[model samples]
Target: MQIDWVTVAAQIVNFLVLAWLLHRFLYGPITRAMERRENAIRTRIEEAEETREQAEARARELEQERAELNARREEILEEAREEARRLKDRLQQEARAEVDELREAWRAELDEDRNEFLAAMRTEAREGFRTLADDALRALADTTLTERMAEAFAARVGDLDEVDAERLRGAVRRGEGLVITLGSDVSGALRGTLTAAVRKAVGDEVEIDIPESSDDFTGIRLKAGGETLDWTLDAHLDRFADRLASAFPTEDARETQDDDANGGRGAGDSTLGDSHGGTAAGGKGQASDAREGAAGDG
Candidate 1:
């Protein structure tokens, strides 16, 4: 129970020394290491935060790119649709044009065919009529036609226009005479009458000659050197046939014949009607002459 002051004091001093050693060697160094660890952890946390922020920014950029790509795809699709529509319309227009062209060509060909057929029919008709008339007239021909035809032909020379008269004069001048061709021999009286008529029509200086021809045409041919005028029944018939041909000409011939037919003498006014009348009258008269000749021969 009594206090030991030196021992107590020594114990207190040792305890103080131990505390100071721990603070300098162990506690101070441990405290410094803890602070350094704390600082390192803080730096690592800041770097992790920075990395996360960068990742978030990158994600936002990717989303924006995806949106842009979708918009561009839509635009391309619309453009493609418009181009297809344009191409379809162009093709349809071309087909329509081709169809129209073909139709026009077909119509033109049809018209040409029709024109050709009509022309052929007209030609056939003309040829058929000419053949029939020639056969009928030849069958009905008789001897008394000689004088009547000669008289009629001689009178026709007097009725010639200035152009025909001039042509005859030139031909006569060249040949030095006028030649009268007959279908058959005529009586001296008829010959004299025809000779007088020719002298009256032509100049008195002209000579008249009658020649025998083998052709069966019942008409006259007046020739002067190279120029010969056909005033025969065959010629008249040919002219009539020509008129018939002209009246119903083909499509190609109508334009030419229309102008000629309108300007020149028609079938009725020209020698066509007159020639037929003469032929008919001469045939009847020749039939009567045949009866008389037969009676005389008997």
Candidate 2:
């Protein structure tokens, strides 16, 4: 309680000195270390925040890439499916076309074979009939077939109508005289008879030539101007063959014959008559066959 100003002032001074020393040595260094540590920690925190932001951006980019990849895969699968569908359609069309081609080829081959067989049968039938007729005529009649044919021709010439006789006379007068072609040789008596008949039909001024030749047909053929007269055994056989064909006709032949019949044409008209009668009829005017007039004699 007693007042001591000097001592108290001295003590105050000492305390001040000690506080200054502590501040300079311990407090100053410790405070500066703490500030440095805080600054370092702050820098680390800022760096960590920046790294987190970068990672988030990378994740967003990855998610976008994944979506794009999924879309590309779906597109590729759809393209493959479309390609497969197109291939299937093309294959089916090709298969159908191939089958149709093969079917057509098979049908053509079958038709060709059938036609060949029918033609062969027809040839055989014609040959067989010719052989049979030759044998029968030789056995039944004491005369050769050629001689009988000539007799038939002479008879036909003698019985010619006025129109036919006039036409033959005109042909003989206008062109090269009448020429008679025979399949085989005839006796002098038969030749004389033929000559007389021709002379009676036409005038005696008309020249007549009878040429004997070994022809394929057993018949007589007369040529005057552009006109021809055919009376042959082959013609009779052809008529018989036509009748036989009518009895047993193929599908195509039957249809044709039916159409011809409906159009007022006879079956005989469509056939190849005795000794190329159809040809003579078309190329040169031909007289009617003598078989109808002298059937019994033949």
The global Cα lDDT (0 to 1) of model 1 is 0.65
C-alpha lDDT values of all predictions = 0.65, 0.70
lDDT of 2 by residue, 119-226 (tens): 555556555654565577888876666666667777878888776677778888786689877766788888888788888888888788887675455567666877
- Residue runs of model 2 more than 4 Å from their true location after superposition: 1-127, 183-192, 211-218, 233-298
> Which candidate ranks first by TM-score, i.e. highest?
2
Q: How high is each candidate's TM-score? A: 0.34, 0.48
TM-score of 2: 0.48
TM-score of 1: 0.34
Q: Which ranges in model 1 have alpha carbons more than 4 Å from their true place? A: 1-70, 139-158, 167-298
